[model samples]
Target: MFRLAHISDIHLGPLPRLTPRELASKRITGYINWHRNRRKRLFGNILESLVDDIKSAAPDHLAITGDLVNLGARAEMDAVAGWLANVGEPDFVSVVPGNHDAYVPGSFKLACRAWRPYMLGDDKPASSAGENLFPYLRVRDNVALIGVSTAHATPPFMASGVFDRRQARLLRTILRQAADDGLFRVIMIHHPPVRGATQSYKRMLGIGRFSKVLKEAGAELVLHGHTHLETLYRLPGRSGDVPVVCVPSASEAPGGHRPASGYNMLTISGGPGEWNCRLERHGLDAQSSKFELFHSEDL
Candidate 1:
């Protein structure tokens, strides 16, 4: 079986001090929010423990669905680069950006440049420049991981995402190609594809277009992280329903309406029309102060 570990919304904390010039734009709102709220809940120690737990499982590949930083600062990206190194090399890991990763203008480009290794397409030639756009594909074993970017800078108090027409068209092409190869297609995005996954202000803007492409192109599974809650939604596919799974923020402390830090372990085996898969949900246990298995289900 091919084991894949998925985690999202790490929201790494202890944000670096922002200069006066740095706080002169959209980042100012994020900075204030982080200091007043997120700093206390998204603990670094919790994130450290969660990563250690994931490493112990030793999945063949890791999928991190973004929010690796608080304010999308240069220092935050740099810090996450080292953290990504500790998690695994680019070949063993795949990532997609989230709304927080693109907190302001230009920050999204900066993140893409810094985290290129984990986001580039696998089919690119050796001499090809590594600047592949979104809707990149990485083939490993019998699985095709199709990643799309929905992250974009938004105004104050808004955490929305956008997947433009260009990305939607390219994603449809990639999905069909993967299907033709008889591979287990797994679509990864930072925002949930299903409606009502988040509040109106934080909703994905082009989700209707995304869903239209998915229904036509089809996929075996869809993985996302944005709501900071554990959720499951099934969407229409060519032959049947496609499973869409979302996990809580990877660094959320226990208590409150939001659940604790958690991740999804997906095991895929068999082949073609007879595929077999399993999902294991792991989360921090506040009473035990360690990560533990919360549930397991077949998909």
Candidate 2:
């Protein structure tokens, strides 16, 4: 079986410090709340617990969907890299940048500079630019992992992301190639493929076009973050079915009666056309020292 752990939005600590550009862009309604609650030790504790959980689970690979930083600050990226290093193997962990990771104009550059050692593999470059922001692809014995960067620094009140025409085209080509190679293609990004009817303008502005591309190319699964909520949606393709799973923030404060933070473990088995997915949820506990299995999705 190919076991993979999916986690997202672990806004790591030493929080609330913003760049001049980021501070200016905080006029949005939700921005203040994110800053106020995101800086606490609670987030760090939750992250620590998550690392423990991942170590215990011991998945063959780990995929983090993004938002590792609160405001794209250099210190925050450094902190996130340190936290990931403490967790386990860095090469097994693949990540894409979220909107928060690109709060400033050159935020990606800063992230690359700070997190290069962990992000780069033996075959991959230490840093990528422009359309190659998420240029890494791993084809293991049982899984094909594809990561894409959907982070873009937008105007205040507009939390938008664009893969750009070049990246979109390359992604389609990659998907087609992966399908042809008979691999279980898993696409990872920071934005959802379908933003729902109540979608905010600030959330994945070009998802429609993005979805169209994916539908045409085809993939077994697409994982994303940035919604800060748990959601599952199915997208039909001509060749087969694709399931898109969105995970909540791994360290966000619980809202209403909902669990604050959680992650998904996907087990892939069988072969080619007979592959199956089993998704299990792990929630943060009171001590924030471990994650307990809260629920399991029907297989």
Candidate 3:
């Protein structure tokens, strides 16, 4: 069996000192939010514990769906790169950016560059695709891991994501190619594509187009993390229901309004027409101050 571990929304903390210029735009709002509220709920220590647990589990591969930084600061991105190095090498970890990673204009480029190594596909070099490489495919064993970016800069107080026409077109092609190869396809995005999974202000746009692509090309599983809550939903595929899963922020401290930080361990065995999947959830146990299994089931 192949084991894949999934985590998201790190929101790595201890915000670096921002120059007046850096906080002059949309970042001002996020900075205020962090200082007033977010920082209390998201802790680096919690993230460290989660990572340690993940290391002990030692899944064959790891997927981080996004929000590595809170305000999308250049220094934050640099720090997150260092953190990623500690997590694992780029080849073993796959990542996609989140709305906060693109909180301000031009920040998206910085995130893409900083996290490029983790988001790259096995088949194509990062140099060849430059910054436009979305729907990247990494073929591992009998699985096809596809990474798609819904991250985009938005106005203040709007934490929305977008899957534009270009991304949709490429995603369709990638899904088709993976299906043709008879591999179990897993699509990774930062935002939950299912409607009502997020508030209206934070909703993912272009989901109809995305659904159409899925309907035509199909995928075995979809994973995301932006709502800071655990979610499980299925979208219709021609052959069967596609499982879409989400987990809470990896850095979220216990006793928050949202559920404690957690991650998913997915075990897949067998092949295309006769595949088997077991999903195990690990999350912070607030009273015990440790991470433990909170849920488990077959999907």
In terms of TM-score, which candidate is strongest? 3
Better of 1 and 3 by lDDT: 3
Per-residue accuracy of model 1 over 1-299 as CA lDDT, tens digit each: 89999999988778888888889988888888887888878888888898889889999999988788888888888888888998899999999999988998878888887788888888754433222558889999999998888889999899999988998888899999888899999999988888988898889999899889988999999999999888889999876889999999999999867999999999999998888889999989999989999899988
| CA lDDT for candidate 3 | 0.90
Per-residue C-alpha lDDT of model 3 across residues 11-34, encoded as one tens digit per residue = 998999999999999999889999
Range of the 10 consecutive residues with the lowest summed lDDT in candidate 1 = 124-133
**Model 2, 163-250: lDDT tens per residue?**
6677678778878877888888888888876766225764676677677777799888889988877788888754666888887688
Pairs that collide in candidate 2 are none
TM-score of each: 0.96, 0.88, 0.98
Model 1, CA-based lDDT? 0.88
lDDT per prediction? 0.88, 0.73, 0.90
Which residue runs does candidate 1 get wrong by more than 4 Å?
Answer: 125-132
Q: What TM-score should be assigned to candidate 1?
A: 0.96
In model 3, where do residues sit more than 4 Å from their true spots? 128-131
